[model samples]
Target: MKPDLPTDLTWPHTSINNNAHRVGFWILAHLTHDPAYMEKVREEIDAAYLTQGPSAEPDMGLLLCDCPQLDAIWHETMWLYNTASAIRKATRACAVGGKRVSVGDQVMATFRQFHLNRELFGGDAGAFRPARFLDDKSLARRKGYAPFGGGHTYCPGRLFAQREIYLFVAETLRRFYLELVGGAEGTMMPGVDRNTPSAAAMGPERDVEVVLSVQKL
Candidate 1:
């Protein structure tokens, strides 16, 4: 199970820690499924290493992390596989559409739903494309692509989370080339099973598994 981000929680730390192996595995899976993306990342990493050397690792410094392209991949993944899909209300209130609301209102926003919104992210939004965020202004104006959240209730530990995510991904990519296993296609959808065990805030039922290979880079 992965630790999900909350509108109020700081970072996806649990999600990052508990699901690191899972996330790492899926990263490999996606790379295998799309060799092109893998090649692009490899090229960037290679170039960075050429100038700064491999010792200038992502977890070590802000060197490679300043790369926009690398950041995009992290954003896309968070969108596609947010840890939690539901947000519970603490008080009664009126909804935006003039609808009456109440305390304990269970509002759910699946990561897949928002992440794949075609209006916000164009051209096969369902498909994972890191290059989509290359245009800084456009990416900013996308409006609804909030993998973390907005406002004062915004995620507190976002900086920490981003650092961990970027570091983890950069290190994983730097160490090994990835590929999917058992000919599986990546699926970022949730499952249903109320009886399942959960270690985080996410519901007891959520299926997130992607098997992939990790070969020496």
Candidate 2:
């Protein structure tokens, strides 16, 4: 007999697939923009694979835990590209940011504003610097860095989404070399499509053409 599925089953699938695609797109775009950074991430992935033993197969544990560069890239991508907003209702009367919040009042928090906040993220907050995350451990735990939401309503599929992006990036780079079709001088970085309504991650305004070749392993 077939098992029944819940009516909200599509929520997870939509959230994971849509947000992952957008996030992955930005990651690749940034990597293509900076070849040196790409090589750094590639080297990290290679080292992790080598440490996993002779088969050279990717170990989920290492991918999730061992590669600091990849982790930083992922975090930077989320910080720069995610446009998700968190909506919460005030359970009781309180003051936030000096604004009085009445009971049952709805408050919206925009991730983009927080992500781009110069005070919390430093002077280069608007820039896509993966090293920011690596250099500052406290940034991830800060109240302003809520890529997957927070509190009890935090995204349940966050781990799954992260794992999927990590595996995709690691495996793709492991077997292939990718570059923009026209090189950095000829091609410009795509702009964010802010005009579109995005529930999570936002996408590029234009498509970037890339050339992928099998690695000479």
Candidate 3:
């Protein structure tokens, strides 16, 4: 008999950690590279914490809920740059999209595919536009766009991860002014073949080295 334990218990721990880093890095890269977007993000942050001084920490609950703009940024960032792929086994035979799926057949759901669907994301699916998500939260509900997966197989720590990332970002912005050095442009390059276990959820399979100056207030 098989043990009653999750096959990949450590998967969630690593996945959540890497995802949080990815989100934070993407936010930093995107904002610093684009003046317009950076200003928007700064404006939202400034407005939300206008009453609080730099020394005082902004309430996490307020930061999480009050700033729709920031939330939109998080959603858009995840939609565009997410690297998570969910592999699920069909419980019963079913036909989907003109293809028949048998019980126990493995189905891989990739976030990149779903998030880039022109039907749901429009012709400029490749563009970095936060308004797309901010305009309508429903856009995030489109099928196959599972940043943290979905339904029964959804990530258990999705909410906790989001809060963790939001707090990291908010607190960082609160304490330091981060600006990129050498002006590394934020663009999505095609991913290359990799032998890592988390390859499917990796963006570009490479890193752009950028120096950032974080000055404390």
lDDT by residue (16-111, candidate 3, tens digit) is: 655678777676666656657666666666666646655766666777777877788788888777667778899999988899999999987777
By TM-score, the better pick of 2 and 3 is 2
RMSD of each candidate relative to the true structure: 7.3, 2.6, 4.5
lDDT of each: 0.55, 0.84, 0.70
TM accuracy, model 3: 0.77
lDDT of 2 at 122: 83
Highest TM-score, which number?
2
Candidate 2 residue-wise lDDT at 172: 82
Candidate 1 lDDT:
0.55
Worst 10-residue lDDT window for candidate 2 reads 47-56
Per residue, candidate 2 scores C-alpha lDDT tens digits across 17-114 of: 67998888888888877899999988888876754433467778887898888889899988888877889999999999999999999999998899
Judged by lDDT against the true structure, how good is candidate 3?
0.70
Best by lDDT: 2
